[model samples]
Target chain A: MSMPALLDLYRVQARMAVQQQLQYRMRNAMVLVGFLTEPVVYLAVWTAVAKENGGSVGGWTSGTLAAYFIVWTLVRSMNVVFTPYGFEWRIRTGQMSASLLRPRHPVHYDLAYFAGSKVVWFVMWLPIAAALALLFRPTLRPEAVEVLVFVVAIVGAYLIRSLLQWLIGMVTFWTTRVGALFEIYMVAELMLSGRLVPMSLMPSWVRDVAGWLPFKWTFGFPIEVLVGDLGTRALLLGLATQAAWIAATAGLLALAWRGAVRRYSAVGN
Target chain B: MRALRLIALHLRVVAMYEMQYRMNFFLQLFQSALATGTGLVVLALVYAQVDELRGWSRPELLVVLGVFTIIGGVLESVVKPNLVRFMEEVADGRLDFVLAKPVDAQLLISIRAVRFWQAVDVLVGAVVLGVGASRLTPRPGALAVLGFAAGLLFAVVILYSFLLILATSAFWFVRVDSFVETFDGVFQAGRWPIGIYPGWLRTGLTVVVPVGFAVTVPAELLTDRSGWVTLAAEAALAAALAGLARLCWRLGLRRYGGASA
Candidate 1:
């Protein structure tokens, strides 16, 4: 597809997603509320710990901790891509056959659909963010450049997660054990990606390991852009790293799609 | 007694069905260990920074973690599967079959399904609890054990009532699939002692969700921090919640427009 045609496809798919998602706003709101509890738990724990430790632990005061997790809620919502389980379902139900018949890549459709849903999620997230801010009193103040970096970084985080998860989803073509593998991936992300806590709070070895992996770029980097006081040079470096992960994962996904498609023997009607 | 027999019958069928997928038990073990390991590491990190967490020493906090796992295991293995099934049935209008059963509809619905593999978490939790108890300078005595047993009984009752009340909401709204996820997220708070939270959230966890009562109160009994008065209060709360749940279930039943009706 030409560039304009591809853009049009994304526009149409995203519009459709927004329409479909809006119909179930109540359901989505419940899920969003469910998402809120995680950060609240984390915030409450870390704040208590920080307070007990003479008002700081590993350079994270209670206010900054609040900002990190509150921003975590948004970054998490931004990076909610299509999961590997969905891929397993699509192939088992022969939905892949319908998708393959399309002229464009199937990933584009998913990318657009989830992007559209993010629009609705962002709207829903506003009231939630406000409530958290009021309760936790998160101390978030970003410069103009940091604000610019955050916007680019979140988009980068979204693309990187989407492509990597799509690559993981492609594994369903070979085996049905993707659930176990996905759980493993999630644990690694939880520990290494700064999802559970800030990297500063983690041991140095964990921080060093996280630097090499793509998980940090998806979660910790984008969140730190707005939450932490990273220097301008470090912020640019993080964005560059996010771009590199996006490129590498997209390239790997393109290769994996070839093998996955060839291996696919469509199942359900 | 009839409820016990019904649960036993369901367990037998679940066991036979699960025996075919024996490898899944190993998978569950691995996942449960991974989760438990992560919890321990977080505790390590927390304790590394301070001697105690708002009067909760590391080992005392470990007891809380263990109780959290055990309660979570019970919920996932029995309560959650049934609750999800109930919600799905409500949404699809298949609940008529359940309501027509010979046994009490509430009892039947609550005991219908079990994920046998998920019970691995209970074993994992017991092992953690044993290790935590062993580390205490003065180990827990028989009185502590008795209190723990009673606390656990009340905890399960309260947790089950909470799940039933949540499931009963399906009768009115018909779709609350995300309720399980929300519950899981909120339940994570029980990993820490309820005392660590602010006054308002602590009260919310205690009364609104009762996660504090379900996990922390039991752990406190094991650690000799709570007395019989607390246990008696919990017992009363459990009875009241059970009554409330029954009332809610009956009221919801009146709203159930069955598929065939």
Candidate 2:
């Protein structure tokens, strides 16, 4: 009963957020272009590269590369957590102090917000993803089981992503240059997260680094699962690795939040 | 000359405003280094797979990346921040003060704010261009250099106008901060040779976003100077686009004043 009631509370908050976001509807609509643009442009460039390479590179054909980026749009939509950028304001404006007084953890609050805000972007991407599938002629032959596993991987990816972001948000307790810091972090993620190109297509060193990093788990793992590239044993290992990272990061996040809240001074001291 | 003087004065004021913040310029320096490093790394990775991407060698693509870096820096330092601020003003009905200025609103909006730190990108781009040019076989001739200068100027004009028109739409839409980011996404295509794209996307980049004229064609001019016709047409298009953006600003202004008058 408690579990069901908690879910209901989250549902109500989601509904409230959806209503609030309506005022910025046009803004969200514009943001959709960016979500679609980054991957499509990369796909086009990679497809051209593949063409020059006699139709394949790093074991990925043009069609398979196309499939990878299409899955990218969905993965990207599910990974919409930009709260780190606003953390400075929350602390500076004394919002964090009020947040600390609340019963549920701040992570739950952030998670609910992320889930709420993503609904529009998620719903809107369906038709665009469909249009891209028809245009790209991707070689997607995933089994139903693989598709289910892809969903689970994506959920795990989202947790790691948001938790890391929340930890970054905690930087406001020490410095006001969070924006600059975030920009630096963003460049690293852009490369490591397989946003720029496929990991297989990247340098061996980059693939090696990203293989052990959490950024790839957020975007790359789900796409690889959808691409149906992993064997059963590899799939289990990848998911296990992802789960391990998520657990580790969640623990780090708890420690950081404790320290951050302790340093929080609502009086601007 | 008057506009130049105004810009010089505005630059100081903007600098003073930005100086109020406790700076970590070194961190920004580090950010630029990381960004440039990552870009070079990506280029290297792509080149590692193939000898060239669509007939553009590593050095030539480095030049393309250089142009992209410069354009992004200029946009961030001047065009983008001001346009975003102008859009916010329009949304909240605070644009009248800027319109009330004696200067041209377009010029005023363009020079409104500057994050001087972004000059790092320009410096990095110049260094990259120099290194890239040093590696070109037979080097570019004097004509190629001249063509590159002309194309780069035109590219700047086209991009400024494009962004101006986009920001002006806030007069109608009233809230379009995210719209600028979409332009940013489109602009990333300029990092590569426009020819590398398929036919439809190539046309879209060239005609729709003008990233072709902005970077690739300029890079081409530097590499070979072979497309005099396209160069001339682009110069013409720059003037035409600048005029269109001026017309858009005027129309939006009229509508704005009428609604808020």
Candidate 3:
């Protein structure tokens, strides 16, 4: 597709998603609030630990930890994507066969739809963020360059996570019993992606491992861009890393997609 | 007595059905272990920073994790599957068939399904609790063991009632999976001692959601940090919530308009 056509396709799909999701404001609000618990729980635990350690642990003070987690809620909202579990249903129910008929790849639909919903979630996130700021009193002040980098990084984070999870989801083309595999993936992500805690608290080896993996780019790096003290060199390097991950995952996904579509057999027809 | 038999019969059928998928047992076990491992790593990180959290030592906090896992197991294996289906039935108006059953409607809905393999966490949690207890200066005495058992039972009741109340709201809204999702998120907070939370959150976990009561109180009882008075209060709270849940179910049923006419 031409660039203009692809942009138009995204625009249409995103608009559709926004319209559909706005019908369920209450439901969306509940889910948004649900997303708050994980970060809030992590924040409280780390803050307590920071306090007990006499004002700092792994260089994150309580106030800065507050900033990290509060920003965490926003980054989390941004990174939501089509779950791999949905693949089981799609393939088993012949939904994948229908998607295969489309001129454009099915991933575009998911990318656009979720991207549109982020607008709603971001709007919903504001009041909650304001309320959290009041309660936690995060010491978050970002430079203009850092703020600009963060905006770009969050979008990068979304693409990296989406492409990677989509690649994992494609494994359903071979076997339906992918639950255990998905669980293992999630566990690794939770550990390495800075979902549970900052990577700083992790041992040096884990940090080294995370640096090699794409997990930290999707979560820790983006949050740190706004909240942590990253030097100019590190900031630019992190963005480059995110771009590299996006390209790598997208390439792998393209390779996997061809094999998956060939392996697919429609169930009812 | 009849309800007990009905529950046992339903569980047997579910067990037989699940037995056909034997590999899922190992898969479930592997997933549960991974989750437990992640939790233990979090504990290690926390303890790496401090010796205790709000006076609860590392070993004591391990007990809290065990209780959280066990309660989580019960919720996932039994309570959640049934209530989620109940919500869908309410939404689609298929609940009339349930109402037509001879047994008590509430009991019927609550015991209709169970994930036999998911119950692995109960055993896993017991082993973890035992390990945590073994590390103590002195093992929990018989009295403490009894108190823990009693507290855990009451905790289950409180948790069941809390979910039941949420499920019952489907009668009014016609769908409440969002609330269930929120509950799942909130329940994760119980993995730590409630004392560590800020005052408002602590109250929310205790009063609004009851996860603190469902996980922490039992853990505290086992560790001897709570006494009979706490257990008594827990029992009273469970009974009151059970009563409230029953009332909500009755009220919700009256509002239900079946699809079939």
Candidate 4:
């Protein structure tokens, strides 16, 4: 497909996904409300713990902790990958055949849906985030350069997360129990991603190990830019790491897709 | 006697079905252990900052973690499979067959399917509870043990009832799949002592979702923070919610009309 033509096709797919999600407005609202409770849970715990510790524990006053978790929640909403969970079901039900018949690569169509849904969710998330900001009063002030880095990091992180999830979804072609495999990955992400706990506050061993992992780049690096005074060097380094991971994963995905197609063709459609 | 026989039959069928997936069994073991480990590590990190979290020492907090696992595991293993089956049946127009069955629909739906692999988590929880209980300098007495048992039973009832309420939403909505995920987000709060949260959030967790009653209050029973009044309150709330959930289920069923009418 030509570049402009391919872009137009993706645009149509994105529009379809957005319209489909809009049909379930009530469900989307309920889920948004439910998700809002999570940040409050974290805020409540950290606030109380900080109070008991004479207004600061592990170098975090309540305000700093609030800012970190609130931003973390927003970033989480942006980075969530839904297509991977659906990929297995799609392949099993013969839906992948239709995608395979498409002119452009299947990943573009899926990416369109993914990005489109994230846009819708980001809009839905705004009001809840505003209310949390008022209630928790998080202290988030970003410099101009840091803001630029933060935007780039969020984009890079989302791509990395989605690609890794797509790769994980390939396991569905081999086994029906993709959920079990995903759960193991999720536990690793939860512990390492700095979503469950601030990386600074984690035990030394955990922090050291998390430093070496890509999960933090997907979840933690952007928030760290806003929440901490990470210098230009570290910011650039994190962005570079994200780019490297994204490139590596995309290449792997292409190889995996070729192998999957060959295997599927050999099995008769 | 008939119910016991029915439950045993269901358990056996589940075991047989799950026995085919030995790979899944190993995956479940790894995943469940990883989950438990993550909780323990988080607790360790929290204690590294503060000696005690809201008057519960590290050992007592481990009891909370254990209760969280047991309740979550039982819900996933026993309650959730049935709930998922019920929702799918409703969606796929199979509820008519289910309704036409001679057995009571509520009882049938409640115990229809089980994922036996999650029983591994129950064992893990029991081991964690035993270790957590033993690690305390002064062990809990017989009364404390009795209270833990009562509280744990109430927690299971409350959790099951909550699942019923959520599952019953399928009667009105075309898709209510993420309700379980939302419930999970709320339930994660129970992994820690509810006492550590602020009053409003503590109240929200207690009344809105009842994670406090489900896990923390049970943990408190073992830790000696739960008084007789708290235990009584929890019992009353569980019975009330269970009643409410049954009423919700019946109303939803009436509206559903066996997915055919």
- The complex in candidate 3 yields a DockQ of 0.87
- Model 1 lDDT tens row, A114-169: 99999999999998989888888878898888988999999999998898888888
lDDT of 3 by residue, B108-216 (tens): 8999878899999998988888788888766788998899999999999999998999999999988678999988988899899899999999999898889976799
For each candidate, the DockQ is 0.76, 0.70, 0.87, 0.53
In candidate 1, what are the lDDT values of residues B1-261, reduced to their tens digit?
998998899889999999999999999999999999989988998888899888888888888888889888998998899989989998888999988889998888887889999999999998888788788757899999899989988999999999889989998988787777878778888888888887888999998888876898989998889999999999999999999999999999999888964
* Model 4 stretches with alpha carbons more than 4 Å out: A34-39, A173-177, A265-269
RMSD of 4: 2.4
lDDT of each: 0.89, 0.83, 0.91, 0.82
lDDT minimum window of 10 residues, candidate 2 chain B: B20-29
Candidate 1 segments exceeding 4 Å error:
none
Candidate numbers sorted by DockQ from highest down = 3, 1, 2, 4
What ranking emerges by TM-score with the best candidate at the front? 3, 1, 2, 4
Each candidate structure's count of clashing pairs: 0, 0, 0, 0
> Which pairs of residues collide in model 1?
none
Candidate by candidate, in order, the iRMS in Å equals: 1.2, 1.7, 0.9, 2.2
Candidate 2: misplaced stretches above 4 Å?
A: A1-5, A21-23, A267-269, B16-24, B258-261
- Winner on TM-score between 2 and 4 is 2
